[model samples]
Target: MSRKQYSKELKLELVKKHLEDEISYWKLGKEYGIEASIIRRWGHKYETFGEDGLEKQNADLCNYSAEFKKKIVLEYLGGNITSQDLAAKYKIHAPSTVRTWIKQYNNHEDLTNSRKEGVYLMAKNGARKNTTLEERINIVEECINTGCNYASTANKYGCSYGQVYVWVRKYKDKGIEGLYDRRGKNKAISQLSDIEKLKAENRLLKAQTQQQQMEIDFLKKLDEIERR
Candidate 1:
């Protein structure tokens, strides 16, 4: 899906929420229509320039250039600007260039931005995430594209392999709503009880097999004595 942009008022409101500790960075990004990570950029905007961070920003922070990428990013952040709108203004060929720039801004400092477990910035400040299913469809596609096995995908997403398959397969069949965890909606599908029952049955079967093997061994010993 294409990204949505935020207005000046909206940006300021989200920043207020961040400063107030009322909304987490990730949630604020969702509310303001920016990526969760971009809160870091907003925070940097606040830290370097104070309240001016919420203003319609312009210019670059890294090279000390007055021509900040902020204005272009701000428009795109509103989530309405089309890829064509972006290419013309930013003189970039790809819409994803704008996305990469925003990601850069987000890792800047906005500590208020929320992150999941195992996501960290490398030396280059680029991110590597230990996948969680915040966006189930997207994550499942990633796993498929990467050719990872289901168990591996489960490990990455903090779910069981069975769950990864279930969510992804449901999304493939039914679309986004299918990704909403149904574990709460139906206990029968939750599998915990079923798994426990199977475990109990398996224990009983194993004990029966062990007893039969002991009997067989005893009979073999008796036969040996008879032969002797």
Candidate 2:
């Protein structure tokens, strides 16, 4: 699926809920139907630069000079910050923008007027995840056999909690083939029949709701202790 863009106002609102209310990112992601990683990135931006950090950015703005892109890429390679961090710091439109620049630099291609090679760099330094197809199938099967228990499945397999959740959902929607990465691209939801899309969304909402309940229970315990 193509990346979804959020407005500046929405970003600020979510950040406020995350910071001022002390809500967990995963819960917020469930409530708002956004990825928890995106919420964490917004929190990072808000902490580093305040309101201005949440400003809406678009690549079409063309505000970044070639020199600026080169500088950002160099700093990123220097290990000062991640692509997400650099995007937050510079108010770049997307973290992928910096990733594109970094990919170009690493590939010995020109940074200026460069394009992404359609690789999904989920980690820093353009590292491709080494999770084998067998591993992915195992993870999804385990998650299912465990009643979609993402945390336990992740722990058992040394996978991220979010990764397990995503894998399970994709497996449900498209069978085992859905677990493939497809190199930074996926079949867009628009291509799905209306009923299929609705079913997928309903499944996501149910999983997210369960996660939120767990977080709430944990927070309540913490609150009781604080009041003691």
Candidate 3:
């Protein structure tokens, strides 16, 4: 799936709603069809670095000095904060970059400013690689242990970033049972408890209702514009 890019204006608007209006991230996420975690991260960034934190980072402008990388890496290793928090605090684009630096430091690898030699600078989109259940479990464990660093985990395991992210999410939502490949098997409603089925249906219905409401509001604005 293609990643969606939000404009700075939209980001500021959402961040304001989250901060000034005291809107909950979960509510905003459901209403706007974005992850609550992502919204929360945006709020943190906005708080830590102001509007500049919400600005989209240009890859060309991401060059960091080796000394800077070492400083951030050491701070992370100190365990005072999470990688996500560190990224927000330091204005880094991705927490995975911080995790990658920590991994390199722990492995006694050279920390260089050269992007060519940087593992974290690899392409975000990569070919999906098939893995055994054991490998998947290990990958998910490492990802969780490393503060959910999907990009670095994906790079280390030779899989796509999406795969690592999805696997980790599934693991969190359903535990070990979620890791099993049930593609060809029937996903019958009988497998779910009554409460589980009802909850799932309610979530779907809520999303649909919200979507319809947005559509109606959009059409109303269009009609009003036409009448003027």
Candidate 4:
């Protein structure tokens, strides 16, 4: 499924609500059907980069100096900041972009300027490949094991980055059974066996627990940064 797009005006309005109105992220998210983390990200970007940060990123690839990338990667590795904060500070398109750089740095990959911008563009925005269930499982597993580097995993599997991200999210929320193609099927919870239902519930609980812990960590870090 394609990801939903929000307008610039709407994004600004939501950010303002969080910033100016003192509305909680969870309340806004529940009312708007967006994840609280996403809303929080928007607010952070707006704070860091102003209105321009609310704009959708262009598909055109961005080139960064090797030195610049190394600086950010090292800062991230220093454990003083989150990838999302670093992305906002540097005006990077997304936190995932920062994570990709960190992944490359950890793997001893070259952090050279993108001499082949077209290849990066195609890899990021090209047509997604249709893969078998086995391939999807393998891709999801590798993505998880590799620190959830969706960009690299997508390139490795010849799929769109969005595909890798969505698959991993689904796997987290529903387990291995979620990776199956269920288009045009209306499988209800009532139709599931007891074991299947229990497994799905467990997966959902696990995902929620992880999200809660991440939020807690982010808030604690934010407090520390503010104190400093």
Q: Whole-model lDDT for model 3 versus the true structure?
A: 0.63
138-205 per-residue lDDT for model 2 (tens digits) = 67666554445454455556544546655776767776456666563645434557786566555545
Model 3 RMSD vs true structure: 18.5
Best by TM-score: 4
C-alpha lDDT of candidate 2 relative to the true structure: 0.61
As a whole number from 0 to 100, the lDDT of residue 3 in candidate 1 is: 57
On TM-score, who's better, 2 or 3?
Answer: 3
Local accuracy of candidate 4 as per-residue lDDT tens digits, 1-228: 998899878888888776545699999999999999988777655543344457797332456778888999989867788899998998876786687787677655677674343344224344567776657767876666555656557667777655676678777776766777666344444566888757655654555565456556656754766676
The TM-score, computed over Cα atoms with residue i paired to residue i, of candidate 1 is: 0.24
The global C-alpha lDDT for each of the candidates, from Candidate 1 onward, is 0.47, 0.61, 0.63, 0.67
> What TM-score does structure 4 among the candidates reach?
0.47
Q: Between 1 and 2, whose TM-score is larger?
A: 2
lDDT of residue 182 for candidate 1: 44
- TM for candidate 3 is 0.42
Off by over 4 Å in 1: 1-4, 60-228
lDDT of 3 by residue, 1-228 (tens): 998888878877777676445589899999999898988777655433334456687342337778888999878656567789998998886776676687667545567673432223223324557676557767777666444556556667877554676677676677655666565343443565778656554543454455456556645744654555
Candidates arranged by lDDT, highest first: 4, 3, 2, 1
| Least well predicted 10-residue stretch by lDDT in candidate 1 | 119-128
